[model samples]
Target chain A: MALRFALLAALYEEPLTGYDLTLKFKTRLANVWNASHQQIYKELGKLHEEGLVSVEDIPQQGKPDKRLYRINETGEAALSDWVNTAHNRPPTRDPLLVKLFAGGLLDRDKLAHELADTRQIWREQLAYYRSVEAQYFTSRAEMPAHFRFQHLALRRGILGMESNLQWLGEVEAMLADLAAGV
Target chain B: MALRFALLAALYEEPLTGYDLTLKFKTRLANVWNASHQQIYKELGKLHEEGLVSVEDIPQQGKPDKRLYRINETGEAALSDWVNTAHNRPPTRDPLLVKLFAGGLLDRDKLAHELADTRQIWREQLAYYRSVEAQYFTSRAEMPAHFRFQHLALRRGILGMESNLQWLGEVEAMLADLAAGV
Candidate 1:
């Protein structure tokens, strides 16, 4: 459901080929959402069938043709309705949280190691987000409207990672106390 | 899938009737995941058929029989494998971020309204989590091992909600700036 809106949003920006839209998911939209290139290509077809998105094919010399997608007016109205509607957040499919919930069934030390590994992963993620912020947002006050919103999404990701790291540290401290029989 | 894992984890804790499992999902696991009462009953039946869970019909006086479920050895081993394996985090399906991504197609004021509504929702969620933490964790140092892990999960929810609220504030400020045509 949201994937359809995501495709509509990307095509709203500009006319882009299927390959280009997939790249945006990998690079630009990685912060807020993650859709595999395969998934993007599949959903684009569905959206086209539903008349929310229109595709135009361009013939290439000595190459396969490229199909570019753009959102139609109906798609714009749909996207607007989705943006305004307040609903429950998406379902929770977080493995890490489930692991923590079931941690008593795991070896304490092994669980701690896993927690540390997860923290390390987030550390790298935070670094990556920080570098992105530093590179593109040095002069955010003058940033165009679309980029400004993009920066907001990135900022959300950074704050989320930071909060996760903080929670990991606190949990690790508890694990130490448990080991000490405190 | 992860929902199966969640069910196994709950059954691992203790043998409970399907109703009890659904209630626990609504309360204890609300922070981490959610499952409807009907879904819970359906999955419990599947788990029993697969031999991952065993059911005992306990007779109740002047009441309906209760089908209590417990994890079998196979289920325990399956859950252990799931807890130990490090895998990809679930896809990020944040609607607010999607809205921000499509802000260009939306009216600025309506976007701001939606943002405020989202922040209000999170504010309520944060309050709920804080109350839960306060009710359950009075003396952390002497807590049981399992409860400690549960506490860690609750803390994760609290921190995540806090981060979300902060991000909402920041984005709202950005929206203000956008309105000022800055």
Candidate 2:
């Protein structure tokens, strides 16, 4: 899975058990790549067999044995090799885009309602991004070394929602004109 | 293929041979939902099998028989059903975002170079979207009744690119700060 590389990158920071990896993947990597715990467990097994990661067995008192995975030199090299190259924007498979493109099929009233609903959704998303920024952008001294990178991802999310909200306004105006036969 | 629904929507415009569908898909749907001619042809076959579309075999003089496909009533109902509901934003799988999240993995110079390259790419893309707008937004009267819908999709592309360009600016400045040990 493409998530393997992301998991490798996470482990590069420090050794973490499967649960920690899943949590990190949720908060830290949630904006870029999202993976389920089941998927992460599966990839950890593969990384172990591939020798890209080393597992540490930590015996816990009265608890199940904890297995932590760390990225080895091989995994570090692999991640760097993958990161050195340029990456392109992915092709559009967005269902909203598809629906908008097929808008002629919908009744004008129905279409307007759809656009209005989407606008509300984007507005809520913008607020969510702001909340995220507020929580994380407390101070630079407390910032992690990778904070800039992670912050960029959050900023991207904010910018995207802002732009979408603007377009939705324009769309609503256009819908008004269409409904009025303007 | 999900592309089949897109194809069905395209056919909803009017009956067209596979060739016409490809051209329209490229020019009109390229930004929102891109599909190659080969994929379109494959979907058309599936659509026919599912009774979503009806094909007309047109006789040609000393050449291959032209096949035209049109969306049947079932297809129209399905398309409407699909379009009326809300569509969730697609999950992010961007490699650049992934890279940014793992910024400590790269040398500062290398990361700066990658960001610069992406900035250049997005700049070029902004120009491309402008060209596409000039081509389509010439005269509203010439547009189909669905023109408003199609036009909204194009505007969405322009806005997204603009937002990305702005975010890239912030990122490049941040990279410079990091490089200078700020």
Among all windows of ten consecutive residues in candidate 2 chain B, which has the lowest summed lDDT? B139-148
Candidates 1 onward: DockQ, in order = 0.66, 0.63
DockQ of model 1, rounded to 2 decimals: 0.66
After superposing candidate 2 on the true structure, give the runs of residues whose Cα lies further than 4 Å from its correct spot: A57-66, A108-121, A138-145, A179-181, B57-66, B108-113, B138-145
Cα deviation in Å at residue B61, candidate 2? Answer: 9.2
Q: What is the alpha-carbon lDDT of model 1 when measured against the actual structure?
A: 0.83
lDDT digits (tens) for residues A1-182 of candidate 1: 88888888888888888899888887667776778878888999998898988889999999889998889988889998887776567665577778878877767767777787888888998888889999997773587888888888889889988998999899989888888888
Q: Is the docking of candidate 2 incorrect, acceptable, medium or high quality?
A: medium
**Top candidate (lDDT):** 1
The positional error of residue B157 in candidate 2, measured at the CA in angstroms, is 0.4
* Model 1 per-residue lDDT at A165: 92
Give lDDT for model 2.
0.80
lDDT of 2 at B169: 88
Best candidate according to DockQ:
1
- Which ranges of candidate 1 are over 4 A from the true structure? A60-64, A180-182, B59-65, B180-182
Q: Write the per-residue lDDT of candidate 2 for residues A12-53, one digit (tens) a residue.
A: 778999999889876656667878899999999999999999
